[model samples]
Target: MIAFEPTEDQRLMQDAVAEFAKATLLPRTRELEHARGVSEDIRRTAHEMGLGLVSVPEAAGGQGQGLVTTVLIEEELGAADAAAAFGLAGPGAFGRAVIELGGPERAAELLAGFAEEGGWDRFGAVAWSEPAPCRTHEGFATKAERTDEGYRITGKKAFVGNAALADRFVVFAQVEPERGWGGIGAFVVRRDNAGIRVGERHKTLGLDAASFGEVVLEGAVVRDADRLLGDGGEEGFTRAALRFFVKHALVVAARAVGLSRFAFELAREHCDTRVAFGKPIGHFQAVAFTLADRAMDVETSRWLVWKAAAAWDAGQSERDALLASARAAAHAFEATMRTADDCVQLFGGSGFIRDLVAEKLMRDAKQLMLAAPTAEQLDQLASAIELGQKLDPALVLPTPDTQAIFT
Candidate 1:
């Protein structure tokens, strides 16, 4: 009974993003890779196209696209370059959380600034990961104690994505040492906030252009207005945080699917033209079958991502099952990576060289696994299924008007 066909509007949206990615993004991959940072031109083009603000609701002065649309755009950009796609998509995710969780005045102020600026120089990076025992915010060593002036935050968060250029971070800290994540609440910490410091940029095997660093807070002071959703001492912030985590996970999955497809096409082209034994190598069963399997995996991952996004967009509370969709995607992505590596092997030595596109594609393919919860963490997500627990509540966003904030 479910319809899989995308509407006319959806198709148009998808094509538009794909065109932008090919025309504006692909050409810049090498430049970004070498520069090790985002390019102003790419950012400007994304801002002009409204891609930087895609997830912001229309009321918030953005395109108001849902996760499905976001992923579609993400796929195109990711096919071109993962870091650039992330630079475009990560901010939108941050803005969405702000609109849903921050105070009205603060949210309006920030959203207005975002609209005026076209796009933020730094992307929105959520600082949630902490050292052991507090993994996933279940417990945290960071503390944000209420003070006479506001709150004094003291904690350290590691490996925050986009931390280098992030203007502000959504940070989780405990008000009571006894509360753990339950006692945990979120606050907005600005780059210049007292005692807030961004640490050394780290290099990774892939997504080289994507900025990763640490956020340190030592006696950092933030005003009360900066407190997110549950500042009134409720679990709303935790709810909002989980929703975003799940959404980011989906974005990662989409990027994996896109890059895999890109690799498949490249392999196919090689097979058709590269003569082997006086004929195209594609005639060989090994190469042909591998490509076919890779295509199957890519298509399957794409389907799961689309379904997951649609579920979230429709406000379906049953969307928790979509976590399974994310895991399926991770597996498919792994398969595609292996296939792409094999395809590169099919290319002989050309695949290992710098001029060949397959080499870069292989590098980017490895990056998809590290995005967000990582493949290992995503695999743990399936544990809920084993425990006979539902993932639905994990996917739902908290309705803003359902509770009184400063009451």
Candidate 2:
């Protein structure tokens, strides 16, 4: 039978990450927000704490943790500060992808530096979004033209996580337009390459510490050896991309659950302390019911997040994984936003100000909603799965008003 409780090692890992997040990430929230990026000291501390290598395989000099453990760690870190968690988790996700999909030599090269003695000093990124009318999976305008030497990639990717500081980027581009989604390929390009340019950071509503920005490939050339999955062709590329997207969706869901839990706890504590008419606000029926509703929402979302992570760790079929992830993403998004809004409401006037963290959590929840595979899109994917339709993994339903929003 499947178990809901974490294993002994998993429990220990969760506790350790929770402690580290509270001690390190929570204390620096204000500073990190002002800086618009996590400090080098905070990054190094995360590395030393082994947070950067939790998901990398043991063969690659990492802890060899599974997706479930990674989700647990992410939940705690996100509870402390979602933006800080993203900064630390982003490279680990890239490292894991390389280990799983990149060819032997490519994996060795990337994993070697990732396992460096000092820390995971080298940043890695994945560029998938592009400047195009269609931002869905089939809408990628970036083209990879074959040449005698290798391939020349030309396009601009917007909203690239960790772009400003990334040393390596796994760029997605179309290699065979006639083949549609199957024609897409992921090519590894170095930041210092001849035509690669990292754009200025974009001012976002939240998750500022993630350093989200643009990456431009003006005919950036790379040899065949640089391609993830090398000669595996379109099928291989599609498989790798789908797996990564599913895993990423689950992680984002876990983060949302964590943020929701954090907001609920803060609101609960505030309700107990803030008194009105000689009694604590929590004693009031309206305040008590709101807190109760949010507590239930947080618990429900947490279970959904764990269910998706557990499905992934069990090696379920791709369709099953996608369905679980989509459900989790949709539920987590709604729950987190509702809980955050309730938190602000509970705080009354203080929540609107910067002194309290309720407003910050609300902003972070909104930013997460805008991230890839939005709640509406995930809901569509889930609906397709239920109907036994094998929809394109990158295909997102477009509404008239939201058509341009994805780009």
Candidate 3:
């Protein structure tokens, strides 16, 4: 039987995160936007709440929560501040990739740091997007060459989240240029590496508080032990990448739903109090209908997000999970953007100002829309799956570049 209600533990977790969002994230949203970064104190508080370790298994010193729980937390956080939610959840992607593909010994060694007193003081990032115009279809331009010691990676990754602040980066590179994504592999590159360069920050449309930039690797040497799927070759890497992508898509969908809900609430409140023709604007059919439509959109998107998250937790097939997540993300992105626009309309001139959050919600919605596996791409993927076409293993899976939004 299908269940829409959250478990007791899940409800408790949701409430806790909701309270934190109201108490911390909401009040700081404007400050962080102005600063263009989340404070270290906020980051530490997030870690202390176990947001960073939500994806890690209990045996690995994490809470062992599933994707559904993580999405629930993300929704609440995103409602308060999208960038802060992204910052808090960003490290989980890297940590999960390590646990899934790096073997138990590697997972133990790397995750141990997360258990330290401060709790993940250093940010984690994945470098996957390339500066090349054909990056989307052609895959990464970065190359990883086999070496006696391990591998030498040389390439530039564009639009990497946390590039300026990440202490560790999970970089993706092709071992054989001719093979494209089939030759891709993932390697852990520390920020302190001699040949690695963190580039200037990129000013984005939204998620302003989260750092986004480029990472350049010029003959950076990586030890064999640092390779996530050492000796498992491209096949192993591709499989792990797909799993990560599906998980990330679901989380992004959740954020969209949250942001849309926030916009809807703002619009609803404005409609209720604002006077028009000697009465509340909400009494007008034109205004009331838009709010009603937005309410429907937000509700629909929320359910879709939950369904995708639930499929993942239920151990559904990768194709099924991916399809669900892709569909949810694409729809949620559209819905949220529309809702944000309607919110702006409801607020009239005030909505356009920075003081009003409606404008910010619209900006944030656009960022989510453009984030990884864009709506158009996701629709195509869904159509391809429906027709039983074989997906390009790498194309369907999330790349370091494509999956950066979830971070």
Candidate 4:
């Protein structure tokens, strides 16, 4: 039989993070948004608590916890402030990319110094999404050419998380144009490189505390050793890359579940207190039913996310995990949006006001959906897996050819 309950250790960590989120994040959410970043004090506190390293391997200078634990903590953070959760300093998507694309051998070398003192100020990013797809090939417009010194990369990546702050980046580029999507390569690009520069930050609708911007690689160069060619066995690099994106999306999905929970709770609390027709609004049938529906939404999304996370930790088949992740992420994205929308509606005009967090949650829910592979993209992935179709990275993964999703 399978177990859905979190282990005692997992519960302890979850509770601790929940406490921090409520005390530190809940109150300063607007402050973080107005500042357009997480505060130094909060970052330091989160870092000290090992929030950034919970799912990383010990060899990578991290806590060696599983994805299950990571989601639990992420949910807590998302419940209080989803934007701040994204803004917290850490390797983040960059770490997940390296582990999957660069192989485990490089994790120790690439992930160093992310967990040490002053690490709160350090960050890493993945430059996956481009401003537009390549018209010539079914891949990124960014090109990386082989050079005697390594490779010369030229391109612009957009919608990158921590773009303005990260010094390290996993920049994906076209390696063999004829091979199309399969020819793509990922390289470790340093911000200080002579040819790389960060573009202006974007004015996003939500998740204001999280920075998203562009990175311009004007003939940037990297050594051959900097390239990440995963040992993907017979299935090759495409499968590995897909795995990376799927897992990354699950993390984002877990956060969506928390956002759903937060919105549902907020709406429920309002219904309990706000009186209408001579009693609490919740006493009415419509209000009570809506709350019940949202309650189910929260629970369903949580279980789906948990099962997907558990599949990864349990080392299930790649197909099984991929399907689970894709479905979970897609469902959570839609559920979060619905829950937030209903929350705002229940607020009866008060939700539109920034004084309450309903409007913010609604905005965040939409932004979070695009923050990863996206519900539409994930649905496609799940269909491909369930139908036993060929797993093409161009089709399943969140590529520029499909959609320029935020990383």
Residue-wise lDDT of candidate 2 within 1-407, one digit each (tens)? 95589999999989999998899889888889888878777778788778877777666677777788988988998899987877763354566456656854566567656667655456788776754544444545788999998999998887777887778888877787777666777788988899799986778888777678888999999998777763376555555665666577677778888899899999999999998999999999999999999999988888888888888888988789878888887889889999999999999998989998899999988887765567887788788889977555345432222432211
Clashes by residue pair, model 1: 320-391, 320-392
lDDT of 4 at 236: 71
Relative to the unseen true structure, what is the C-alpha lDDT of residue 141 in candidate 4, on a scale of 0 to 100? 90
Error of 3 at 226 (Å): 2.3
Residue 398 displacement in candidate 2 (angstroms): 10
> Residue-wise lDDT of candidate 4 within 107-184, one digit each (tens)?
777888798787898899999999887898788899999999999999899999999999799999999898877788
Measured against the true structure, the TM-scores of the candidates, in listed sequence, are 0.86, 0.91, 0.92, 0.98
Best by lDDT: 4
Comparing 1 and 2 on TM-score, the stronger one: 2
lDDT of each: 0.68, 0.77, 0.79, 0.91
Better of 1 and 3 by lDDT: 3
Candidate 2, residue 325: CA error in Å?
Answer: 1.6
Model 4: what TM-score?
Answer: 0.98
Identify the runs in model 2 with alpha carbons over 4 angstroms from their true place.
Answer: 103-108, 134-138, 229-236, 393-407
Deviation in Å, model 1, residue 162 alpha carbon: 2.1
lDDT of 1 at 315: 79
Clashes of each: 2, 0, 3, 0
**Alpha-carbon RMSD, each predicted model:** 5.9, 2.9, 2.6, 1.2
